[model samples]
Target: MELTVTPAALDCFRQEWAFGDGEHIRVFVRYITEGDPPFAFGITRDTPSDAALTTVAGSLTFFMERKDVWFLQGNRLTIDCLGEDIVFQLL
Candidate 1:
């Protein structure tokens, strides 16, 4: 698995979330049966309990816990901004 945060996303995190140096950002998967995709990606400010993968962009660190790694195996996950909202893409 790989993770990438676009420049726009990094800026959005800094400006909107007010994230500072060494802050941890968690990437997670949640099931929502009502949604088209069934499963959705979520981002939050959190510390790692059992990080399976981690990457740093700018001053912030983004990570996915061991339990969530199965959702993203062999994929590149990208985080970006669409207008004012955060979007996730797998490539």
Candidate 2:
């Protein structure tokens, strides 16, 4: 439900999404579910938000306010700025 983002990840996010727009990030998440009828889930930002982030899973979509956006390795993560230690909880 939570992950600590790395510094390297933060930089990449800055380049790809934050390079031109000071207002938003062109980010999304993908999820794969195993079942007889396998399913794939993806959540792309529909509205520009400097304060909110969300993703889709199963029958629900989770959302929280974004405090900071950072990247790690080959991935990106947004932190709950309202929390301590850049906590990101996906629920």
Best by TM-score: 1
Question: Which candidate leads in lDDT?
Answer: 1
Clashes of each: 0, 4
For model 1, residues 23-70, the per-residue Cα lDDT tens digits are: 999999999798687888898999999999899999899999999978
How high is the CA lDDT of each candidate model? 0.92, 0.36
Given candidate 2, what's the lDDT at residue 5? Answer: 31
- lDDT per residue (tens digit) for residues 58-85 in model 2: 2223343353222223343443332222
Give the per-residue Cα lDDT of candidate 1 at 14.
Answer: 92
Q: How accurate is candidate 1 locally (lDDT)?
A: 0.92
Where does model 2 exceed 4 Å of error?
Answer: 1-5, 16-18, 26-29, 35-91
What is the TM-score (0 to 1) of candidate 1?
A: 0.92
